[model samples]
Target: MRLPSTAHTSRPWRIHGIAPDFRVEDVWALPTPGGPDDLPHLVGQFTEGEEPGMAGSSFAYRTLFAVRRRLGRLLHLDDADGGVGGRVASLRDRLPADLLAAPRGPDSDALPFRSVYLLHDEWAAELANRTVHAVLHLGWVPDGAGGYRGQMAVLVKPNGLLGAAYLLGIKPFRYVVVYPGLLRSIGRRWQETAGRRK
Candidate 1:
């Protein structure tokens, strides 16, 4: 479910230290509820399939993704020179000594995002292109019940006016189509995995 910005901002996330300049674009409460020790398992949920994210089994999302990719290609939005370590620095460069030494999360071949760090309760990945530099922050948090559930927040630092405009243009689509469909897929996947374990 979509959450208020305070849901993410109120937490004392390590992300605040490094990407203070970035703005929180969206926050969501994920459906994967579990015990305290199950936080790390959330990573496996996303990485299990050939496609690494919420595009699975959703024709609308798949179509939108394809359209965006085609647009990106034609516009040179994702060219190597416009990506991480090119247009903007990787968040990894800003990591503190201890986190730098800890286990970074797995990298995905299908996704442009690269894992920044994997903490006991939080995980972060980043992607940058000509349009913007963005972070995908996932955390395990109390669900107001005894169990814990995954939460997601997207943070972004726009490149310029064009980037800002692009984000603005997509706000309706993100809320109406992208996030709702994605969250539903995530919920279904979480349930399927839980069922398999029984």
Candidate 2:
């Protein structure tokens, strides 16, 4: 479900230290609820965008994906030269020595993003194009009942007027059409994953 920006801002996430300038664009409480060990599965499912019960299942969600891709192509937004270490400097370059030395997670095959780093409770990946430099952050947070659930937050540094305009244009669609379906998919997958833990 869509959460208030405070849901991300209030957390003492390591992301805060790296991308302090990026705005917390969206935060959602994911459906996966398990212990700390379950995080790797969540990350695995997310990175594998073709997971049977995940996002890109519904027509609306797929349509949004198509539109986003088409828009990217038309605007030359996601070109090779527009990626990390190209148009914008990578956040990895800004990582603290410890983080730089830590094992970065597997690179995403579904998205044009590179894995930044992964820790026991958190995983972060980054993508940069013409419109913005974005970070997808996943955290395993306490559910207050002796279990952990996944939390996803998007942070972005919009490039310019075009970037700001693009974000504003997609706000309604993202909230109305995309996120609900995504959350439902995550919930279903989480249930399946949690059941298997028994």
Clashing residue pairs for model 2 = none
Candidate 2, residues 1-198, lDDT tens digits: the string is: 677899888888888999999999999989787886777888877777573233437887787788888988998999988889889888888899999899898776776768898988889999998888999898888988898888999999998998899889989997887778778887777776666665
* Model 2 RMSD vs true structure: 2.0
Which parts of model 1 are misplaced by more than 4 Å?
52-56, 195-198
Work out the TM-score per prediction: 0.94, 0.92
lDDT of 1 by residue, 1-198 (tens): 889999999999999998999999999999888878666667766555655345465777778788999999999999999999999889999999999998899877667888999999988989999999999999999888898999999999998999999999989989977888878877877787785433
lDDT of each: 0.86, 0.83
Minimal lDDT window, size 10, model 1: 46-55
Q: How does candidate 1 score on lDDT? A: 0.86
**Candidate with maximal TM-score:** 1
lDDT of 1 at 43: 72
| Strongest candidate by lDDT | 1
Report RMSD (Å) for each prediction in the order shown: 1.7, 2.0
